[model samples]
Target: MQKSLRVGQILYTNVLPVYYYFDQPKFEDRIQFIRQVPAQLNQAMAAGEIDLGPISSFSYAEHASQYVALADLSVSAKGRVGSLFLFSKKPIEQLNGAKIAFTNTSATTVNLLKIILLKFYDYEISYVTQEPVLEEMLLGADAALLIGDDAIQAKRNSHNLHVYDLGELWHQFTGYSMTFAIWALRKAAIADHHDLIAEVHASFLDSKRKTKENPAPLIDYVHTHFGGEKEEWVRYFQGLQHDFGDVQRIGLEYYYRCAAELGLLAAPTTVDLWQAGGRQTKTTLTR
Candidate 1:
């Protein structure tokens, strides 16, 4: 008997490539994935709304035991990740007294921004999650964490605002890949539908390739989620690459190390995603 595995994904342009299930009838019937912002997706995963999808790295750490990570699969760039951003109406130091807005889309970026504030700038700022608009937060908070399309448009300041790049922040702090999210599965789901996980991953990869060859199907989806320049969004989708291999471990470890350094987690554990626990032997990317 075959059962569809429920999966969850974030609502960002960079993540659209993973939704290839929409076009594949075979995987579609077997997939019960929901598209939501990272934080919401994390909640869905924790609540058993879906088995797995790309999730915020911080959320994974918070509930490490509940899920197993597809270590090779993640959203991270070596440098210059143009999506995540931190903006303030004043200098980072001056931002201490001002109101700032944070995006509610991702749990990981929130903490990631906090690390930059506490460590790099030496600012004891009050962090709050208010709807992200310069007017809404600048009216009351000191700084804001903006991500995805909201970050894209809002962070582009006219010279008065100070922007602290989260990707660059992580690069400066840890020399490995700064993983934002990875395909994650509920711990129990792996026990029953392990093979389906691989198949779905393959399906996702195939979709990514198809989108890369012709992004027309997702252009609107990408433009809507990414927000800034249409060409920039198009270019972003062109650059996304998903791997199901060890290339992601360093980044995963780096994320955990950074979280640990910030006292976010006590001792983090790494998943041998090659075998992914419960599985019998190491399976290389045959997809």
Candidate 2:
């Protein structure tokens, strides 16, 4: 019997479309789904607990030497990622030197927020990581950064609080789409299970394509599980970009450049994409 590939699934509504088809029985024998937040999934991928799945862009960049990204898979947003937000008591510009709280469930957005505030806005702010409770976070800090479902809920109940969508801010600053997460396979797992990995990657691409063709099932799944109006979920899914195309690649590379400049990364890293027939390609970016 072939070993079941352990794949990580982020526990967020944004990833519903990419993973919608995998819940069927057909993938059960071949794939073992391990669901968790991006931060936990990143740790699992690094610890070799999971073979391949969507991981934070920051995690992939930090350990790019250990994994190969799927050439066609990512969780990105072109201009407005409806789920990622910064809820504040005051305006973003006035938050300089103010204490802020960050959700511990994210790795990529934490750094992205730092880049936005420190690099782009030149705000000298301090932050602490806390659970994804916007009320509690804001109780002690002037602002709270939330991503995924927590952010969506917080934004809905903001009640006069200032909300800034990070994706829109990023696009305004860099003129590029922001890729928050990418599907990555550990190099060691690839060495042994290249064929199986390829099958899983194909399934992911198929799932995404089908979701785009008919998003009703995806939205229905979210509505049933997460509890929101269909129209709102419709707009949310429409804003997300799942393909790792040229535009997203350039944006991701630019993000790496910014991260390196901010010392968030030790050095700039190449995005190594896993190709068919067990081949590999590199996308290198320089200053």
Best by TM-score: 2
lDDT per residue as tens, model 1, 70-106:
6456776655567787766666657554444677777
Instruction: Report backbone clashes per prediction.
Output: 9, 0
TM-score of each: 0.82, 0.96
* Model 2: lDDT to the true structure: 0.90
Stretch of 10 with least lDDT, candidate 2:
21-30
Which regions of candidate 2 are displaced past 4 Å? none
Q: Which sections of candidate 1 miss by over 4 Å? A: 1-3, 20-22, 93-100, 156-159, 213-228, 238-241, 244-247, 274-287
Q: Ten consecutive residues with minimal summed lDDT in candidate 1?
A: 278-287
Models, CA RMSD each: 4.4, 1.4
Candidate whose lDDT is highest:
2
In candidate 2, position 206 carries an lDDT of 83
